[model samples]
Target: MNTFRLSKRIMNINRTEIADLIYNKIIENRSAIKTQFLKTNETVGYFFMDDLLPTELALEIHAKFPTTEEAVKRKNIREFKFTAFQMNNYNSLLEEVIYAFQDERIIQLISEICNLEAVYGDENLYAGGLSLMGKDNFLNPHLDNSHDKDRKRWRVLNLLYYVTPNWTLENGGNLEIWPEGLKKKQTTIESKFNRLVVMTTHQKSWHSVSKVLKDDVRCCVSNYYFSDTPFLNSDTFHITTFRGRSSEKIKDIFLRIDNGLRSNMRRLFKKGVRENPHQYKK
Candidate 1:
């Protein structure tokens, strides 16, 4: 198994310290954060950090991780499935950092920043663990699956921790946010090392990961928080649809047809008649 070491200093900050940083940042820029996501300014807001993950821990996790199967489905003719490598069931130091994310301090800070009350998962650790993505893999633009285990609440926030050392823009594997609708254009978010991208996910939040250009894996930690209420003012049901970039014509058509079928199935069978195992449970 691949293995590496955790940093000696940064790892000692503890959960309380981390939470405080998140809280202070939110209070300091509450209005700006809210406007960034809600107003006409922009559909997405981003926050970056150079040391969110202790370098040693990040390196170690990256070394010891295993590659996951690329889950693929036909979205359209040229458009294919959201294929990528993922290892959610974490071992090594990976689990420690991921679970620490749910600390009450951090959650409260995130809730305040987004101007929403923080409600967490009770049945189990709805929070996710570590994940790794390799070359040629891609995640298509789609709405996140709403609700946690048992459909008890609405899943509102997505906290992503990217930890690939020396990951450069030229490498490609970037996070693409399609806030203004795919037909218009897309805003690409760089998956920089130690960067934490916390995004608002509701019925309208449409996002995806671009295809990786190199053979090196792009590793990340993925987490989600659930609330008793939905984030959107209007509660609507939309399937997790996928589409090709503006240029892929025939592929786009096929994906639209594929999305329609899945969407229709969900209408008839509340949960789409299939269990989505992508989520985290206790």
Candidate 2:
């Protein structure tokens, strides 16, 4: 149980402002946005501090959060996850804030940021919750699968709202983006507190959570929005693959094998013969 002071920080753009920004950004620079994404060979784009929340309140939410090893092991990657835990809609303030996030304005903003057409949004908020990773916790590079419940729609964007006050690069738990493959070094994205990162999630968007090294927990609010169509015209099917960084050869081989097996099974039994229990149902 960690005890910390609570605080708040409001942003210049609230719900109304966010919607207007999205619409205007889309209408103004559609061609430039599309061209940038195509040339980068990356599925997503990022926007930061677009909307701000009360810092003290967010810290209080973090203070009250339960720290559980079992939960982290179940949801986190091993050999890393020294301290990682999460709670979903655990309080009214968080729920209210999350609910406000479902507005069309916010959704459109995300779509336009990624230069994609607005398709659909997930207000039900399944798997879209709070996640905390402390010293040593890490997520390996992987591709987010392409669909939502029952393969109904394509999951195009991953919105991460980080809120760890005074967090720094040396604290670890940075996000590594592998625009190229594992053979090439990755581009590291600092998970700055109060900063929101909206990235494209598709076959080529290989990313992972770096290992944390500080005593404080790096907290983040995770959300995913889906659309009726895919982000790429030449997108191919694949599983959520994982890979070790350039150094860990053995781990990389094992993970690749694991991904291959799961992918093969999915292809043989379209829609994955068994129901995926990770879905959020309302």
Off by over 4 Å in 1: 1-42, 69-90, 121-128, 279-282
Model 1 — TM-score against the truth? 0.77
Model 1 agreement with the true structure over 1-282: per-residue lDDT tens digits: 012322344435444544554456556666755566555324544444445544555676566555554332334343222322233443435544565667777777777666678567332444255555566667767777677756768888888878788898878778887778778677778888877778877766778878778778787777788888877767555656667777777767888898889878877987658676544443
Q: Model 1, residue 236: what's the lDDT?
A: 59
Error of 1 at 131 (Å): 3.4
What tens digits encode model 2's per-residue C-alpha lDDT throughout 109-144?
556656679567766454465577877678887888
TM-score of each: 0.77, 0.77
Worst 10 residues of 1 by lDDT: 78-87
Q: What stretches of model 2 exceed 4 Å from their correct place?
A: 1-44, 69-72, 75-89, 124-127
Give the Cα lDDT of each candidate: 0.64, 0.63
